[model samples]
Target chain A: MLRNTPIKRKLTVIILLISTAVLLITCAAFFAYDLFTFRQSMVAHLSTLAEMTASTSTAALAFDNPKDAQETLSALKAEQHIVAACLYDKDGKFFAAYPANSPTNNFPTAPEPAGLRFEGSYLVAFQPAMQSGGLQGTLYLKSDMGALYERIRLYSLIVLLVMLGSFIVAYLLSSLLQSQISQPLLQLAETAKAVSERQDYSVRAAKLGRDEFGLLTDAFNNMLEQIHNRDLALQEAQQKLRQHADDLEKRVAERTARLSETIAELEAFSYSISHDMRAPLRAMQGYSDYVMENYGEKIGPEGQQYLQRINRAGMRLDTLIQDILSYSRAARAQMDLHPVDLEKLLDDIIQQYPGFQPPQVEITIEKPLGSVIAHEASLTQVISNLLGNAIKFVQPGQTPRIKIRAEPRGDDLRLWFEDNGIGIASKDLNRIFAIFERVHAERTYEGTGIGLSIVRKAIERMGGQVGVESELGKGSKFWIQIKKS
Target chain B: MAVLGNILNPSKEASNRRFTHRLRACLAGFIFLLLAINAPAQISREYQLKAVFLYNFAQFTEWPPDAFADPQAPLVIGVLGRDPFGAYLDEAVRGEKINGRPLIVQRYSGIQDVQNTHILFISDSESKHLLPILASLQGRSILTVSDMEDFVPRGGMVRFLTTNNKIQLKINVNAVKAARLSISSKILRSAEIFPPAAK
Candidate 1:
């Protein structure tokens, strides 16, 4: 059975029909048995009565005092239960009879003693009688078997009547049982149909008994309860999800607003640095040019040198300002983390510096760098700064030997820039990474001291760590470790 | 023979109880019938089944040959007074024969008419006639049946009763033996056999 198909009606119908059938079969069997036995016993009794009457009617068959023989037989027949009697002669002829009655209008010939017996409205008996001359006659006597048959017939009729009555009763009972069970089952089916069609679960089945049907009803009710509970739970969960989505939308709106504000501030700050700062530098340059132009004849070489020094000082300040702006911008830059292939990046950066002739630098590059998750531009800046510093501080008369390698620490990428260069004094190593702090004077270095500081700031903004290793009169090695995320 | 012996020996108390029970059922049935006639024409199979059982029981029993002197004489079944079955029993058994004997039912007031009877059915209305009926029936071929207190011990052959408001029956073997009548064993298996009373 499918779980959905209700069987209460079918079950009740089967039980009632089976019970009725059993009852009918039992009654019919008994009726048939009774009919058989009644017929058998009636025949036996009639035969016995015929035999006894025949035995007593021997005198009538002999025709000795026929009147007395007839009277005796008549007396026997006169018994309240006896219907009629007759006597037959040995020649298969009628000799005397009782009650003056015959099943047929004419008396039937006496049957052969060895032949089959006959039965009808009369019950006849045969016996042999001795005559005075040693001769014998077959005596035949008959009595009505009507009453016996009538009794049996009446009994059979009564049984038939009873069977008919019981059948009607059984049929009615079966119908009643069918209705009682089918009504409830139909109701359940209708409710189930309605539930399926309308997708509603509110309807319930009525309990009819404590039988299997009743148990089924209870189960159905429980199922409905569970479905309703699950539905309620689902609704509650959906409501919670909706609430979470609304909260997320609110957070996204707030973040977008903050981002736009930050972008506006950056643009305004960049504009201020670009115009205001450059204007003063331009005026200083123009002033220095005027001084050189108007006082050229009176000025000695030292004076011209002083003017050149002033112009150079002004240009250095401009360059330093530009570097400061660049460093600040790199520090403030937002990161878009993605896969950065260091090998490809290092290769690209090194290619840009191909102008350095005799690229014979024994640069033992470790198995080219692998990809890491980081801000691609910021990570490239760190690498380029280190690589540029190594190229700049080369040992006199030594090939610019460099080794570039990478290592992963946890979720971070660590890169090493080792090179053969004019190593810094141990004491200056610490201060060299600070902004505007250089180991050699500006004249000898011919470079701003802001490179290492910018590198440190760039790495820090990208959530990374930077360090240096150096010994006076040896090459320096700089290392940077960046969080992969 | 065991069945007949058991049926011929029933206890006084059990017979009395059965008699009272039968009397009550007869009264209840009569009342129910009266109520039924006006109430509706619905068939009461329960009552009909009882009637059928009683009719069948008659078929299974045999009367002595002397019980009928003339073959035409009615096999009188006499009820002393107050017929309990009304006319339903009569109608059910009408024109019926048992053992080549035509059935006849009558109400008698005294023992003088009892000699012609084959069965003397003593209802509660004729309870007072018990002793006289017994005395007249002693050593005779008559089968005495009754629904009365201690009817079996008092020498009635059969007692009808009600249990759980359903019809039931009890038998007295001693009474049957005394009547010189042979009851069938099939009927005895179902009937509640009461032991003979202690003298």
Candidate 2:
């Protein structure tokens, strides 16, 4: 509020008005005093003149010599301010008058009482002509009041000049005093405004003097410095947080890129392993069969049996390689799950293989099986593996009997494939899902024991879960749970 | 006097004092005589001073109106016997007016010739007739002055005396008061005022 007011004008007005009032009062008092003194001295001087006139005219008035008295009164002509002077005989009548130019004839036709009086513009005094014995007559003097007025005129002129001088002096002094305060205040205001408007805390007000304004300026500057430092600290903290975020992002990007490279290299190794191992196995099988056929009679029955054994081992090794490849592919491939008709898919699998054709193996799917969320190829692969496992792991003198059905379970569809087969023992249930492991002896199984593991891996990759319930003499029921679309 | 002495002597006081002491005696008379004899063409400065003294005395003494023929009449100083002050007195009083009256010097061979005069100077030529001159002017406001020795003691109003070779005043206040005139105290202070001597 104070900042907005023009301090110089306010202070100057306050000081100037007060000083002018005081100066005018003082000058008026002085002028009044001087005027009073001038008037008093003028009266005193005229009184002296009256006394002198009376004394000198005593003899003339006593002797009744009007001429001498007139002459005595005429001497006052030398006194410029004495307009007229007259002498009154002892009879108290105007007798001898001075100067034909008697200012006015009203020089009191009758004698005035003895004393001095101010009459309009004149100072009239009455004095008795005194001798050693008695009163000779009265002397009347009328002096012009202009003398005192002259003094007043001079004093008035002096008063006017003095008033101007005092005003000028007061103005100059107020300017000097105001600059001491107002200049610093203005500087502080400017700096504070600059800081607030521009958010520039670096701006500082100047400390021009060791006064209150200076202290204020210092305080403002100090506050700005604190804000500037705080801002600097905040900026530093933000910079550090950003740097940390960037570092974190860079590390994550590097780790992700490295992980992708490792996955790609593993896929390439798996593919080559599957493809290369099969070729060599096929060549070995072909050579063994040729030996059995081309030199059957010459080698004898024992040699032919050993060669067949070698051929069977090669075929089993090739199947194991294919199982490994399928497991790796299921684990690494991106599978999109869609609703698949489990009934149709099972029927298609049966028709595609002669083993499931009627008398070879009994495969039954519950009619009108509902659809489920699953990857098309992976889901087919999984079901195929399960069917094949059922047939291969069956009890020795029984054809494989399989049943497929599905039921809704919460937000998911759980499908079950029940098969009449040599059931897995509860102890090997967890182990059954691992690769290259068989619950039964290899001679008893008659096949690689990798079908269930493949099924479990494929179902898991397609976002479905697989589990089994089995007994040693009865069949096993394997279930797959998938999210309902 | 100290200021005058110093002005005359920049370096020493002894010669200044001795020289002025010698000059004190008849300084006015000798100046008058030398100017009249050796420099006849020159105005006598000595009588000029005496003429001024006469007018100055008139200013201090108040006279009765009876001492003038009329208010318009001039104030007369009657030289009762010889006229010592020549044209110097007239020259000194030329165009001078005191109390609205001009001062005039009149020469008188005897007391009978003095009429309506405010002052009477008894010159040395009338020294023997001083008694009758004063007696004739008794009870009048005529200030009596003379250069005769023992004039104040002999009941004269003012006497010019030579003391320390300087012209000095001897006044008899009693005799002046007897003339019914008041002499200003200022003139009395500078004059050697005396009481009536033991008869």
Candidate 3:
């Protein structure tokens, strides 16, 4: 029942309980001793009174003088607790009684053997009346226990008063002293509560003494001191980390801006160089034609052949510059995409190009080729480049039979170009789509190496992918994947 | 036949009267004996109580060392003049001792015969000689007791008085002191002290 009481109340209750028990036991022991002694003294006092009376009355009993004996017995009235008394002669006959006229029945029928005893509520004595060496008669005395009872009642009152006084003092002392232990404990508890609730480790309990409680308070404050320092260190570290991250982000953005500016300048420089070179080459080709026509017999066959070689080299150079421009345009152009029918685009390209006619190559378009979302110029460039490569790379005297078809994927359309050609070897396949990379010699293939690079660049700008599947001397299958309309 | 029956009738009547008188006497004696057995106080004859009183005087009074020849000497209770106690005084003191001394009853015809006696009881016959008897025993430590009137005033140490059928005592403390004997206060408390306080 006392488990949940506060420390202050618990200490006070413990002290009070201990004091009360000790006081109760001490008072009880004293009270018991007093009662025992009181009874012994009462018996001793009554025995003395009885012996005195018995000795005095012996003359009366021996002389057979009832009046004298009555007078002797009546003297006991001065001692009020003696209620009645009588004398018995040597013949054991009742002789006289106290109060002079008390009835015979008020006395015992026969005197008992001599000595004092307690009978009911009275202390009775039968003392032998002796004179010298003779027992003249017996004297009987009855004293009520009123005096002993009165003593007991008075003693109880005193004991009760003493107990009450002790309890009051005990209570006062406990209340005053309990705070000595409880105060420091309560303060420590309050400090701990504040630390937990507010996450503030700065609070500390005040030390009240050089006891264990004070030591505990010291320890607690030291712990809070350590924690507060750690928390401050952690916050400082976090701030530094955030500042470093911001600085790194800003430096990256600055570097990326400088890199893009350099790339644009380089592109402009190349474009201008290609445009300027084309004019001078055109003039050289025109003058060569004029010289050949007017002076054909004067220069002879060697000069004419030399003029033809110069003209062919200029044409090849012009094609190489144009392929470079196309590749750069494919890389840098912004594409606006819309739906275009694959089968129709393929038919137009076939009609526009004379080399793709029936006498030069056999081209077949699947009737139901799917539509794709793409930019028109980029898709046209990509498909024409793929077909030109297919026809040009064929074995000598083998007619290029190219079949074009489209298939639908999940959210996209895939177009395939299959051809009978001298397919690329596995080792050179990865290098084939790079700028100015050609697997066959110019004398055999007769083309610039920029065509496939332009095809890959244009397809990527249109949000499509390109790949090829082939085996040596067997055939090649080229495919492009774009979003289906 | 009628004259003969008349003569026998007188004698028969006389004999019948004699028998009835004997029966009446026998019944009266029996009832008297019963009363004596049942009530000791009522049956105590005057001297029988006086004999007991003499014994009590021997018990309650103290004698000087000179009153006995030795520690074991008999405490002699002497009767002067005619002995009124008969064998009753002997019966009272028989097998009795006072302060470890045996009690012996003696008879003295006069004052000169009262030697070695601790308690001297003067019978009523010595009333005429009470003064000389007390005078001669004056220097001796003897407790003198009697039933004679004004016995203590006549220079005796103790007197037994029967008043209203109860035996009481009158003690002469002056005479007892003169004889070098002491009476217990217990005896004095239940007795009347003489050479009365005023005197």
User: Highest DockQ among the candidates is held by which one?
Assistant: 3
Per-residue CA lDDT of candidate 3, range A28-73, in tens? Answer: 8887898789888889988999888888788777667677788888
User: C-alpha displacement of A217 in model 1, angstroms?
Assistant: 8.9
Model 2 TM: 0.38
DockQ of 3: 0.28
Candidate 3 Cα deviation (angstroms), residue A28: 1.6
The reply for model 3, stretches above 4 Å from the true place, is A98-107, A238-485, B1-44
lDDT rank, highest first?
3, 2, 1
Which lDDT tens digits does candidate 1 get at residues A3-65? 454465455456656766786677678767876786567557756655555544443332223
Q: Model 3, B103-135: lDDT tens per residue?
A: 899998988887888888888778777788888
Interface RMSD of each: 21.0, 16.5, 18.1
Residues B1-199 of candidate 2 have per-residue lDDT tens digits of 0000011111122235456445543453575576545332222343444565676667667887677778778988778887767887888667777777887888888889988788888877787777888888888889998777767878899876544323456789998888888886645544577883566
Clashing pairs in 2: B24-B165, B25-B165
Position A205, candidate 2: lDDT: 83
**Residue-level lDDT tens digits of model 2 in A381-459:** 8877887788787767888888888788998888888988888788888898876778888767655666777788887
Per-candidate local distance difference test: 0.65, 0.76, 0.83
Best by TM-score: 3
Question: Which sections of candidate 2 miss by over 4 Å?
Answer: A1-5, A101-104, A230-485, B1-199
Docking band of candidate 3: acceptable
